[model samples]
Target: MRLPKTAHTSRPWRIHEIAGDFQVEDVWALPTPGGPDDLAHLVDQFAQGKGEPIDSPVARALFAIRWKLGALFGWDKPDGGVGGRLTSLRGRLPADLREGPKGPDLTAAPFTSVFQTHDEWAAEMGNRTVHGVMHIGWVPDGAGGYRGQMAVLVKPNGRLGALYMLGIKPFRYLGVYPALIREIGSEWRARAGQRAAGSAGAAGAGG
Candidate 1:
């Protein structure tokens, strides 16, 4: 993915993809290692124990949500894209794609796959290609404060890809992200729990 380097703590997020839907839960990194196996494992596990398709409505909904995410967060351009018709948006997307039904190929394939797939997505959108770059954020360890975390990504024009790499694993559904946020916030508040009491006693005795 070769994302632009930014302060890890800049754009943060808690993973909210899967938990009850699947396993292999963990934070996602840009350009994840061992592309093929890592990706195939997701679909493989989805069918384990039960059967193909996993028999999970939530999983299906999650997939469908990320598959076509334009409805979640509004697009960049309000008028819609070209001449303010259907393909009119605020910014342009990555290059190489041009035409309708051509959207970001969240497929585990190489960048070329994304280009080819989005070409069709553009065509379907009245020949107006998208304009944006791959966006992913990370959490950096903060000094004198709790640790940090971040969002998997912000798709082009908020258009989520077909394969949600985050959902490949489960545990995220239990609200891992929300928990993280609360944890961090608690750390910043008045420490009144046993741990804080222990710390105070230790400091008093110079231990």
Candidate 2:
């Protein structure tokens, strides 16, 4: 999460947000053709900072155990294409991103082609060109089709960042990402609620 002392060009989509004790600064240079102007709204929304990506109890619980399943066993890799891809990215992946959602999807693939360091991630994406979002649900939607991949910017506290699609592939979204997102978000939210309740209970008992 620590950034290198060497200064690199700040991304146009940079955002600053504080989550608990963790201060987050994220940047993504997506290959979309819309250019920097394309992200004005995203930056504004994230800056306003309403949604707590990690605040929900569901996400917290899911995120807590996710590393175990997704990282160690790699069962989280939908089609099993990415189980071993991570080992090859050792020096290539910066610590901030060394651990993340790994998968066969373009967004989570072993941090290889996209980048190794934060600077590289930003530099590589600068002015890059790629086939734009093309279609929403490319594979098909909930039934055999993907739930459409949408480009979103993510910033984990402490400079971890990326502008990538929340890719929901055929059955991947409905069968996979959607389920996981809800499951994790739900679990995380519940845990946070429990923590709040515990604190309140302790206060009442003391009173």
Candidate 3:
């Protein structure tokens, strides 16, 4: 579900430190709910799964079209990405975060892991239009269990970036995000079902 910006800004997230130049583009409550330690499952699935739930047919087609246009326009060249046209946020990490788990390696994905803790994970992706951060935090639902909260932060490249963001606003809000949320919910439930089945099997063995 879409959430107010405060849902993210109110928290003392490490992202706040580096993303001051970026804006909170969107925030949503992820469907994944579990104990604090279970956050790893969500992060791992996102990082390792080759075909993520967010990559539905329409989304994939949109992305393919975008990439083709990017290639044609020189928008996605290496120089326009991390460590070339843009510097990575990793350089700004404090010593502790630098030394700690830098989340998952996502060579196969568009994003690169920035940092992670028991309750939080962040990754970054960029092209000519924008440098964006995807942050997930395990937040208390006020009923004792924890659910994931996702926030997107972006630093636009220039006037082009601003215009690009404006152009995609409708599609992002109306289609992409909602589909992604449903996918996350499906994956979350699937994991829960697997755990329940395993537990049932264990109980039968004990009996």
In lDDT terms, which candidate is top? Answer: 3
Candidate 2, number of clashes: 20
* Alpha-carbon local distance difference test for all models: 0.29, 0.28, 0.85
Off by over 4 Å in 2: 1-86, 93-168, 197-207
Off by over 4 Å in 3: 193-207
Ranking of all predicted structures according to TM-score, beginning with the best and ending with the worst: 3, 2, 1
Candidate 1 lDDT by residue in tens digits, 1-207: 112324322232111121111121123232212212122222212113122122345554554664355445543244554345432221233332223223332332111111112001111121122322221222223332222222232222222322333443353444333343343334324223544575568789996
Model 3 residue 9 lDDT? Answer: 97
Model 2 earns a TM-score of 0.23
lDDT of 3: 0.85
Per-residue alpha-carbon lDDT of model 3 for 1-207, expressed as tens digits?
999999999999998887788999999998887876678878877876555446477776667777788888898888888888889999988898889999886655689999998888999988899999999998998889989999999999999999989988987877688888988888778678765686679789999
Cα RMSD for candidates in order: 18.2, 17.7, 3.3
TM-score per candidate, chains pooled: 0.21, 0.23, 0.89
**lDDT: which is higher, 2 or 3?**
3
